[model samples]
Target: MRLGPVLHREGAFGGAGKRLGLGWDVAGTVDATGVATAWGVGDEVVALDHGMVKPLGTHAEYVVVDAGAVAVAPRATAAAHAAHAATLPLNGLTAAQALDLLDLAPGASLLVTGAAGAVGGYAVQLAAHRGLAVTALARAGDAELVRSLGARHLVTDLAEVPGGAVSGGGVDAVLDAAVLGEPALAWVRDGGAYAGVVPQSGPDPVRGIRVAAVEVAADGARLAELVRLVDEGVLTLRVAETYALDDAAKAHARLAAGGVRGRLVLVPGAGS
Candidate 1:
């Protein structure tokens, strides 16, 4: 089985008082079935065990998830790998759901902060695929990367993004994947919308700008669509490193050090 750990800030997991297993994304072959369902033993699958404080998480050698939360894994291809597929469920779903909250139409202008990051990267590609004009805000070095991901405009510095530029006034919407908070909200025009990755933690609505945060949920059907995109080469998955289950702490430390450009995966029984 393959797993990916999400290292979130304090209270991101609801301030759980007890120790909890640490994983959200999992990809592996089904080992058994609880009932007569579409899935069977030896079937390749992926799932999002959606929760913040579960006693056990997908990091284990085995996991039990609602069948509805599981989907057939992406077919292996030159562009897709099991490790890369393991990074999809959580980040891909989060980006797609956040964009749904924006509800922007084709040709609408959108700015995505931290465009080089996982959720932001997917948001860039998906927004562009939907025909939105995407301007990515990322580090200067990532300009080409974000542009390659379908960002039409690139701004290395927040100061370079002028207010009231898109749609004759700020961009139509902002996807604050970088969690820039109030500063990012200021880029939205009046009556525009803002969607954030952190639930209920976005800046308050101002100037008639509608604001909401995405609380990611598991939707197997939706995940299956994303898998199709990956197979079609419309989406890209990046893996920064892999660690064995026993080296989870080291993975956490690597994450804390920052500069990670992709997801960190954990392979059970594999060497660090």
Candidate 2:
């Protein structure tokens, strides 16, 4: 909510994978791994920061992940779905950390800006599961979507949210997932906790309320939990469109257009 993307260059579990400006979330079968590990030659796995031998990504056919960072893929979710789930870890972890900072109990008040976004959607469901009064602030089209994720209150615009209606003089916690600067800051009620993914735009949390920029980490355990939700049919993966790996330029263009809703998956096996 307060910041924009935070870029980092950190190595994953294996000494094999190094940060080379690669994508984080990844899914694939281990082509091969080292000795004394549960993952074998053909075991399918998901890993956070699992880069293929150093600069490669999930967009490729093969990737190498450290044994510790991976877990078995859910049988019910498709490969594409599992691949998409790989992307959810960072955003999901942001939601988890933000909640920890808020320190609110069940039935507390929570608001997520950019509720229709990748991470916002996760935050909404997580807050709802915690039994909070979830409110989603997003474009008018997203109201129904957010509501389905357990947001009881949907505000198409900030001016529309009830003033001082949430606990502690406003929503108990604010997760800013949209435009980082003023839009997100203005939405958080005074005295309520605020968290942001973009450190560039929002006020850092100082007062009793905590404010933070979001940077998601890879956690196979957490990813598995999200996987469980999808398997139970409680969570759904929405892909607006997919592009072949070679058509990556067009995919970038499409994402730039902002016309695409849901995730844009890149199918490596698409027609070459």
Best by lDDT: 1
| TM-scores for all predictions | 0.93, 0.81
- Runs off by more than 4 Å, candidate 2: 1-20, 50-54, 80-87, 164-168, 199-201
For model 1, residues 45-143, the per-residue Cα lDDT tens digits are 888999877778777888899999998888862223567778899999999999999999999999999899888899999999999999999988888
Give me the candidate number with maximum TM-score: 1
lDDT of each: 0.84, 0.64
Total clashing residue pairs per candidate? 2, 10
lDDT of 2 at 240: 68
Residue-by-residue lDDT tens digits, candidate 2, 1-272: 22211222223223343444445566666777788787787666667663323555555656665666676666664564554655455566667666666667898778788888777787888788878898898788877888898899998877676554433356667877674544455555666677776433357553355566654555677767776776676655666676777886676566656634466666667874
